[model samples]
Target: MSVPPAPALPVVGDGLLDRLLPSVATSLGVAGLARPGDRVLEPARRAVVVLVDGLGAELLARRGGHAPYLRGLAAAPGSRSVACGFPSTTATSMATFGTGRLAGEHGLVGYEAYDPATGRAFNELSWEDGPAPRAWQPHPTVFEAASAAGVEAVRVGPGFFDGSGLTEAALRGGRFVAASSLAQRVDATLAALRTRPRALVYLYWGDLDKVGHVHGCGSWQWGEELEAVDAELRRLAASLPPDCALHVTADHGMVDVAMDRRLDVAHEPDLAAGVAEVSGEPRSVQLHCLPGAVDDVLAAWRGRLGEDAVVVTRDEAVSAGWFGPVEDRVRPRIGEVVATMTGELAVGDSRRHRPELLALVGLHGSVTLDEVAVPWLCAPARRA
Candidate 1:
């Protein structure tokens, strides 16, 4: 049996964060930044980019009743959807957004990626004893470019993220303002805007995504969280300083996966055969096979998963433009064979992943419309 072909790939190099951020920075006169073709933001003295994790365009449209503010933005004339790169997870999207580069260029391929130097699956978010963030992703970020060009860049998020690995790799060069609550984050963003004539504020809200992961995206808990986020966004928009714009976007969308649809690779002999490690999130799995075992693993996965997944070799994925011109240095970090969940099914290795991870109700990191498409809601500054 052969693996089914992948679904149509997302349009990379445009309508995504890699271009969106650079265009935002360019609008602010950031040196070395070029304007993207589809410029979404207008020239403004200050810009507030709010990243709502797991808020997919489809999810937002489906659950619009719960988020009036976001819904209105979505209904606006120029509002549109953008695609996060392949394996549309937080770490990968953030790297692309921050650096204005693809996953291949930034090298943060997924939540968990193979670090060739360490020969282990390292968590990109945690980055504990792994490679140095600067060394791992050496690209200068949009925030850094803005800061260098005399535009104030500030990041408002959790206190622990001030110097975390992901922050350093993708989001460094901004004034780190630790704000735990949504209200606090909004206040911090407003304050940062007031301090500089030209500023770029990046605010992160994760409650909805967290709730979605545990309770599923369609659950009441997720709806409640979305309401809270919508209220906060309303407040943020209403409180924006003069000549400022608030751009709301998300890292990726998610889908609810039933436990019955999840395949545990650890218990399956053929799925585990010739596999050295299983990294990446459940929805998009990376199989690092043993020497010359790539064919066996691919065949095994293709035969078992059938039409449920799109399994391809690393080279095939790169050629298909999944990672967007993968560089030589970043090649080995990718798995020998990659499997992306095309539907509601997920593949997990229980031996490697935690029970909580395997039990996650909502999952992303695939190219499905529910996972890759996110809203780009623009709320220009309005006077009181």
Candidate 2:
């Protein structure tokens, strides 16, 4: 596919994280603080990127001791945090990381969106059973680019994701290695790294995120999971062959919305008046208002949501760089107004759908520092 030039949008205050440049620059041989090229730019070598599903920078900062390996990475000189794009949700942020494009361009939009074409909420993550991957998101991932460039790329995750819709749309390029256990995943990642001199191995761990969503980020189980994952990374780092590098990052962070703050649109008539549809997560509510009701929607949302959220029109969000450079194709996916939850939850009729969402102990999809910021950790490759 021909790479189209990104639009000429002003690259400022887009709320899109600038911290990702270092990683992209490092991977592609551009100069940056954590430039992998400095050490592993050799034509034949290995590079490992471990993506911990729900680990955020703020979470790391508060509970550094919980994960010693990751803590050391964050505290290391030159380590920093990057902002996840608007809504700060996992699917959207991961697509951005994989394709190196904004949500507007990739068109993943949110975790669940009312697919205009389908007239129902399309869940991108589970689309393997929901829709064809290419039909949902047609863009080529950066993994494919690396593979075609002869840089061997491998994706190591759980068995369930081997052929899932999320994998195809955002992570289609690499060879898939499904491992159900952390030990298995770590082993698979190390094995893939040893196969080629120049390799990109992407590893994913989702248990922490799962625990957080179930028990909230404050649970001891979630902290223990972080420690366990960190221990696995440390083991992998120690076993790296000579002349390699390992980098650690995440899709986004988590925020635990209070139960008292939960507002059901079904029961709240004022909040439902102008809203044509409510998609995205409760924290990041995408309000598709009735025709000519954009202003009324904004006002109602602001008046109702109050200081608990950052309410902005879709145009304002695009102008503010919320989605990076908005592409012509991605514009329609955004609603006339979006309310990013700040201090509470704006849940739908949880009785009808999203029991898990209502039960989630930890939440995300907001601009709060906890949800948007992620860490960048780099270490010299381990040599055998």
Candidate 3:
């Protein structure tokens, strides 16, 4: 009898966003970094990583027809689907991607992570009223590492990101080149590559994720955005130098949750009872409990959410490899009781969350396959 294939590596460590950049740095001959996924990339003098926010592997598979260029790259050799890990939101995933370290080590564990030092939750994406960004996440980014090793590192994204606290914390190494539109960003990327023989460039796009949050991931608008991205990337691919390689990836995937299936904690006394705070996103609800209230809060959330969510104690979640070796410093940021929503169900708080945010068509930040599975697609540039 033929032997079954060996079980895949756990999504927490090996096949993850934390390793993608290290692999890229490795392929570019950057020294002093261990390359866990060395073979995930091919050796190249120049590399361009295009991070399409909210582009999940499963979503791309289901909507392949709308993104032919990206779909073809996914089908190419060396292309595979990798996990974005637990709490698969942009802030967490970007910390993982930029630092080549897991959320536990990076300490930006959630979109709105609780800072034990300040005794308050802050929006990691916005970095408003948060702890000093450098003090929060002190890891040297892969960009910084690569630059130190003599590779030119550049980041091409929105102008507002140019010296933002989030940039200072996680992505501080690279020179920032702001481009407002996709076309401008693409042009900027091509120009940046031409300036140096060995360079690591990053291009960020968010319109797809914006469309998904407002119009739903499966909506025609999202499909059209995908098509537009595919067309733009196709144009980019044709202009790439032969010595370069292009890697396309994402922060997380999304799933649409109907308003009827959502629970508003402010509207439900039982759900909000003993929770000191609610910090995480709708799909992944983190409930910080009052002193001596862990068990009660866990039980209450469990009984209330039922099969709609998998409720767990903070200790239980860490043991389950959810955050991938969380450090002691990062422990309190996680809640006493955490709930990962199941199916299309979600829990939001009308009191804590804005009405517009609660009305978002698509939601993420959970361990579902749709939320964690991101594409690891790569292709070489055209011949000169």
Candidate 4:
């Protein structure tokens, strides 16, 4: 089957993250949240959100044979077969996922964005040496909202993320349970549900994303991982409380760029001219131009990269609704000039990024359908 045609998605409206949490909030009759599309998620006593990182809808559709349970969900009318908006990356998507708001509102702009306050580039995912989590992302997450409403919220993931900057910034609140394996995580999810009659449970799985990064998403390794994910989720669904609904989703999709398609600025003088720093995705580069050189830097990058990428100023991108209503504070975190790759091209910065990062087979963080489309599948309580 041909991949589904995915036009540019406006996060404010056509995003799964837009209403996911708010819908859950409404299901529990939690007020204060603007509950747009609350009907998407059926009213249930409990809800379990299983976030499979890098599990794009397009990829799943293409390789549906490997995921019988997911394929069935994709074919279901209620399932959002595709999900995502601009700058499709983990950290940015997770911000929207947790807060049920736009990237501009959440302020986790990109994979790596320039911080005007520090005059440095920081990774939004790892959040090492980055801004204070609470101060940086002031928005109250859905977990916090659920907690405030007296709903028991549980987030299950690895041990390292218990107090990580990203977790605190985007997914704070609730009891964080650490489980190393898939079975352990599933057990923890069930345990958390038992603790409360009405609860919001979140499960984060990074194995597929890691496998996709190391091996291309189209590889057999990725297919194997998908099969494993499908089985575990199926098991989890079977084991879910009869009153609880299970929702399966992801942060973003993956696209495998050829080694020859990744262009390093260090190798091209013209591409690096007038540039102060480089951040963002390899496919979508955020160029922080030197003072009084925004035009020149944009021109140089546009000229050098040619048709492989669409280069634009940050102001233009914001105006075009790329970041979805940029706030005064987040305006500077975006690059002076942003270059989002058109196809399988990536702008790599060898000087700033480690060599290991450049060697990744699968890369995302662009608006392309392959990179932007994620799946939001629901296993409703009635079905259980």
Best by lDDT: 1
- Clashes per prediction? 0, 9, 0, 0
Q: Candidate 2's residue-wise lDDT over 205-319, tens digit each? A: 8888999999888889888898899899989888887767777878888987777878888888887887777778777878778888888777877888888877788887787
User: What lDDT is obtained when candidate 2 is compared to the true structure?
Assistant: 0.73
Superposed on all Cα atoms, model 3 deviates from the true structure by an RMSD in Å of 4.6
Candidate 4 local lDDT, 1-384, one digit each (tens) = 122222244332145565677777667667787654445456888989999999988899899899998898877767774456668898898888898877888888888877888899899888978999888899898899899888899999999999898999889988899999988999999999999988999999999999999999999999999999999888998888899988888888899998988889998999888888888989889988888988788778878888777788887788777887778988888898888987779889898889999999999988777888788788777744
Indicate the TM-score of model 4: 0.95
Provide the global lDDT of candidate 4 against the true structure: 0.84
List RMSD in Å for every model shown: 1.9, 5.8, 4.6, 4.3
Clash pairs (backbone) in predicted model 2: 14-321, 44-197, 45-197, 216-361, 216-362, 241-383, 242-383, 242-384, 244-381
Order of candidate numbers by lDDT, starting with the best: 1, 3, 4, 2
Whole-model Cα lDDT per candidate?
Answer: 0.88, 0.73, 0.86, 0.84
Off by more than 4 A, model 3: 1-14, 36-40, 381-384
Error of 1 at 156 (Å): 0.2
Per-model TM-score, in order, reads 0.96, 0.88, 0.95, 0.95
Clashing pairs in 3: none
Off by over 4 Å in 1: 1-7, 11-14, 35-40, 382-384
Off by over 4 Å in 4: 1-14, 36-39
- Tens digits of per-residue lDDT, candidate 1, 249-297, equal 9999999999999999989999999999888888999999999899899
